[model samples]
Target: MDGTIINSIASAERIWGDWARRQGLDVEKFMPTMHGARGIDTIRNLNLPGVDPAAESALIEKAEIADVDGVVPISGAIDFLASLPPERWAIVTSSPIALAKARLAAAGIPFPRFIVTAEDVKVGKPNPQCYILGAERLGVSPSECLVFEDVPAGIKAGEAAGADIMVITATHGHPVETPHSTISNYDGLHAHISDDGKLSVVRG
Candidate 1:
């Protein structure tokens, strides 16, 4: 729900950039690769020679907490979510539980009834574990769930899980490729959720 439901990418980038700079690392090269990765996995993939793992963990933790206050809900997200039947939706995120909760609470977003966090999944986005788990937790088959994602990795995960995915260009700054459909904003998302529980973009 982070980048899609709440516009937290700028805040996330700023926090990671500051942390990377303090560690004498190249934020530009590192931040992009870390975008949709699990928190600890992002640090591990950095493979910074001579860097202390414990210190990196501490830095990431602090930065994520500090950035929470800067998160804002995407325009129309609240109304779109409100219009849906909660039982049919869920949040599958790469964020660890603590950081996810912080960002959601900061953005004043209601906690999703079914949530699958990075901590709960063995594999992260681009692997589909989170999305699959979310579908399971919601008592729905993957094919019946409609995933809303802002990044290619998240979109890939949803697709891999057999769900029809919808792309929201929030964090990626470009369109994500998804087989089902895409929307620039959540303004028409409610209409897209049909009576049969399938989602489709409303044509003009």
Candidate 2:
């Protein structure tokens, strides 16, 4: 959600950079992997000695929730999301529910009826389970889902879940290498549902 529909890189990096420094880690090496992942899962993966992943993640979430100063919706994201059927589109985000809501509000995006947030999943991105569950809960097969993602792990997750993907490059600091379709934003795109109820997103 952050990278795909919302651009919160400045706020995110500020908070995460602080966390990295606190852990005496290199920010450049540490920051990239943090995007498109649950904060707790990211912290847990670090295996930092004497660190409580849950607590550390909670702290980070609090900071992010409170720091939405530069958070803004990607160009055309708001209108694009509004154009889609609420039940047909779900936000499969790695952020905790509170933080997700906060960020969405900051970006002026409404809450979708169904959101597969970090709390709803047993595992996070790159695991396929999150996206798979999202598809299942939305009453669609994974192959019927079209995921918009901005990070490699998320793209891999969508691929593993048998879903098509569109890479959003709006917030990328450097070129993202992906074979999947790419879009800088939701501009010039339109969402359509056929008579049979199959959703199709097309570039206008």
Candidate 3:
């Protein structure tokens, strides 16, 4: 939800950049793979010896919760989300629940009734567990879900879950790796539901 619904790019960069520096890693390589990755998963993937993923993740989450200074809703995100039927959508984020809730509150966005966070699943993005759980919680088949994502990992997870994926391009100057339609933000978009239980989004 960082770049998709919430404008927390700067805050995230600050926090994660510090983490990278502390790990003696190059921020250049660190950031390119930052989006849609859980902190613990990322730490483990970095293959840093002697680093405890869970411990580091807790520390990172603490920093994130305290670093909500610039967090705010993405343009049009509020209206777009408010327009959706509550049961039709849910947040599937790579952040822990505490960090997710903190970011949502900082952005003035209400917490989604159904949320799947990093802590909710054993595996993180690119594995589809989060998206699968999200669809299940929303009482819908994965094929019936349309995922709005900002990172390659999220796109991959959505695809693996059998959902159509759309990339949000606010953080990146161009689209990342999602092989799907991309939008800069929620602008000019509207969602509709048909009598036959089909959901469609139109660009206005």
Candidate of highest lDDT: 2
Q: Which ten residues in a row have the lowest lDDT in candidate 2?
A: 195-204
Cα miss at 52, model 3 (Å)? 1.0
lDDT of 3 by residue, 18-86 (tens): 999998998978887877899898888978899998899899899999999899888889888877888
For residues 91-164, could you state the per-residue lDDT of candidate 2 as single tens digits?
A: 99999999999999999999988888899888898999989988988899999899999998899999999999
For model 1, what is the error of residue 83's alpha carbon versus the real structure, in angstroms, after optimal superposition?
0.8
TM-score, model 1 to reference: 0.86
- Give one digit per residue, the lDDT tens place, for model 1 in 1-204: 877898887788888888788878877787777677776767766687887755676578677877775689887788888776777678888887788898989988899888888779876778988887888998879998778887767778888899887778755665555565666777655646668767554533
Query: TM-score order of candidates, best first?
Result: 2, 3, 1
Q: Taking the candidates one at a time, how many backbone clashes does each contain?
A: 0, 0, 0
User: Could you tell me how far off, in angstroms, the CA of residue 108 lies in candidate 1 after the best superposition?
Assistant: 1.5
- Candidate 2, after superposition: displacement of residue 48 in Å? 1.2
**Model 2 reaches what TM-score against the true structure?**
0.97
List CA RMSD, all candidates.
2.6, 1.0, 1.3
Better of 1 and 3 by lDDT: 3
Error at 70, model 3, angstroms: 1.5
The reply for model 1, stretches above 4 Å from the true place, is 52-55, 175-180, 191-204
Which residue pairs collide in model 2, if any?
Answer: none
